[model samples]
Target: MKVMVQPVVRLLLSVPLCVLVACGSGQEPSPKQTLPLLPKDEVLLAADSSKRAMIVEQVLGFELAPVMESVAGKIAYDETVTARISAPVTGRIVSPLPALGSKVNGGDPLVELDSPELGKAKQGYANALADARLAQGAYERAKSLFEHGVLPHKELQEAENALTHARDDVSQGLMHLHNLGVEDEKIDNRYWVRSPIAGVITERHVNPGLEVRPDLAEPLFVVSDLSRLWVYMNVFEKDIGLIHVGTEVSVTVVAYPNEHFPAVVEYIDKLVDEQTRSIRVRCRILNAQGQLLPAMFASVDVRSGPENKAVVIPLTALFTEGEGDQVFVKLGDGHYKQREVKVRLRMKDRAVIAEGLEAGETIVTEGALLLRTEEANEQSEIDAP
Candidate 1:
């Protein structure tokens, strides 16, 4: 009884499987799709054709603005507000070097140096003052003696000349001391290197005992007003015509990828580099938040002159036929015309039309190639007669 029951169950399962296979094999195949009909330069979609296969949109006017993109640039301090602090006299740096990133005023001391040059200048000035005082007394005595005929005119004249020379020496000595930044009150050789501008100290190269000189290759300190900065870009000659002194620009940096810094063209080189055919373009940007730093590499986009209005279309909507450009212009009721067009410019994803198109006209933006294929097939069939 058990063997008979197993055979019946197997038979029932096998019968259902055979029925399913038969049902699938007997079904009719889907009907072949029919393409749109073409008449000369026009295409007419079949009644059963799905309209969603292609995207259609009204043509609109777009302003064509000249732009220089992805230009390599660098951030720098504005020279007008930046000062490179260096020692005027040779000396060993004393204690308390100006801290990096410290805010300072114009006259704030940055470094103190003890130099023999300062001491010598001070001594020379003091000696010159003493000599001038003695010469004045002698000149007065000589004048009195000359008036009373006790001294000869030649002797008085000689004394006057000596006095004049002495006064001149005093003036020279005083000027020297002032040039060394040594005040009259300080008798020692303590020379303080002060900042010439009110800004934050962005650099430092001095230690407590490091020797410094006036001709050091690098300045001991760099103080700059971080509120403004300069950006330098190298622009090639082909695009230089579009840029001018007042052109607007936008800058981006790797460190701050999402932020856009606005800038204006401040300077442009008159001479182009013979080898590179490039010129230096300088721009100024306001950095009130101190987000940009000197030496940071940046990408700059130069937004040149005013833009011209023109009709533009998506690149997908444009089709090439032999040597000319063409697009499918919709003429209502699933009818489209393949019209020749002249492209003024080919951008990344759009084409600027110079002729054969107008604003407010409907055009095929996505399926231009479909119409092109249909027209070709129809032409072949008609020629086969």
Candidate 2:
């Protein structure tokens, strides 16, 4: 009888356990569903208008900004003001060469050459002068005789023709000597290499007793006016159209990185370099202080177009997203929108906007990354279950 009672008790306990399980199952909660976050082009800031003002700064608009193109360049001599001093006649260098960096005046003798050819030319000139004098005397005597009816008119005319021919010979010989740098009053065998322009001797290749020739590949001296300089820039073919004569340019050199030299575009090559596919542009710069030197590496900024009103902003305000550049613009209150902008030019600390921005729109100068971080957090939260 006791065993039968134990079995009935166990059955009652099992039935109660099944009813408890059913009740617990009915009270279970369903999985929570979340809403999607804001789109990538937008973000909502947690800060209010007043707080945002403290965190970031904004400007209403910008004035006209110059559009510029930067290119690598090198400083060079202004060819218009530069001279390559070479031996005018084939000879040996007789005099001491002008020291490098020496200031010279126009027509100052820099190198004296003892040229046998020059000596011969002088001798020929002297002989021609003597012949001319003899011819003139004969012509004068013939004219006088003809006037007194002592000589025939035809004879006097022949004498005049001879005199003219002799004078022409004398002129030709004297011109030859003059071309050799021989003075009329001081005709000598030595040929003086004179500076064509007043400048400093930038280079010297000749020494005393060195043989130099008119056709020498290397110049004896290079004289340049250091008061002016030239910068040669390799402008891309696409930007060649913007570079024209008289365009304003600013140049910076490694020696004076903080200083910007003012210059003007003086020339542009008609042909493009086949290897670089770039056109050569030349800019003339004033070097009154003589600080700029040739062969110095330089950075050239060529002002392409006229100054126009553009949406300019600090470079710090820009952010890169994948292949595009973006900036956060304050919409109103605590809202911000990520805008894709066309960067026309990027300076050291400023950016010139070409599109996707207007004059009156306010931008986030600071706390932009905070807004972006908020956007990412929202996305992650929406993805979480």
Candidate 3:
């Protein structure tokens, strides 16, 4: 039981199909048909916004900041023991080191040595002194005779020369004994070695009866005056000019972060190290609690340069597109241009410009990322169509 369609209904379906076929074959559109399009300015704005602001990449040109006014440095011992002290002559140690870490006066006994060589030096000095006394008397008698014309001038001169030689021998012999640790009063085998300077003993080399020699396998003792110390720091080639003598600076030690010691620049190296490309700056620090130690890894900062306005820009403004750096600056009115700038260095959150933008110029810190992206996209579009 199927229903049959009328002939007029069949004719209406064929007419609608013929219209659809005519439209698909690119026939002109009807009078009311028109293409839709966005306005040119709106299109530009849309395209620019589509490039999108980079994830809130904020940028702003900061006011000219004053050059840094202050800095810091470190403290250390003014002198250092580069080479350890060794026994001058071979000897047998008699007494132990004189009270480790004791503040000793100059010429104080540091250690005592027992050696037959020391005794021999003392005997030689005594013999030389006796000879000098004999020579002096002979010279005096010869001078008197010469004045009276009984002895010749040459004979008196010989006597004087002999006395002089004897005296020199005695002095040399005494010094030799002294070097061997022989003190003036004690004439026994053991001799006392006097300290060279007033300081604390840092190291002890030998014990009693141990043979000491000039060999520097280990130091006998290290003595240093801890009251004053030096802090040495390396300044990079660019930062070296900031360091200068008499500049007061601060030092912070890794060991004591809570405390920052005040120090002054004592020395600035004239030469830069070839390997590290750094110059050494020496700072003098007063060790109040004797807390500062040598090679303790301290940080130093020195205040440098006169206060002046430095042209700066936001770090995000630098677009390293190719070989050069570039930024967009808003000229007077709505005009903006892609500008190339030379960055001096990174400053805090911004960058210093050695060239390019001037102080009064307004730069497009914000929306720069979007502008670059738009420019790149437009270039691609023009090349495509």
Give the Cα lDDT of each candidate.
Answer: 0.84, 0.83, 0.68
**TM, every model:** 0.69, 0.70, 0.55
Cα RMSD, each candidate? 9.1, 9.5, 11.3
Better of 1 and 2 by lDDT: 1
Q: Write the per-residue lDDT of candidate 3 for residues 100-153, one digit (tens) a residue.
A: 768877767777777676667777888888899999999999999999999999
When 1 and 2 are scored with TM-score, the better candidate is 2
Lowest-scoring 10 consecutive residues by lDDT in candidate 2? 46-55
* Ordering by lDDT: 1, 2, 3
Clash count for candidate 2 is: 0
Model 2 clashing residue pairs (backbone): none
Q: What value does the lDDT take at residue 94 in candidate 3?
A: 74
**Against the hidden true structure, what lDDT does model 2 obtain?**
0.83
Minimum summed lDDT over a 10-residue window in model 1 is located at 61-70
- lDDT for each residue of candidate 2 in 258-351, tens digit (9 for 90 to 100): 9999899988988999999999989899999999999999998765445556777988888888888888887776778888889988987678
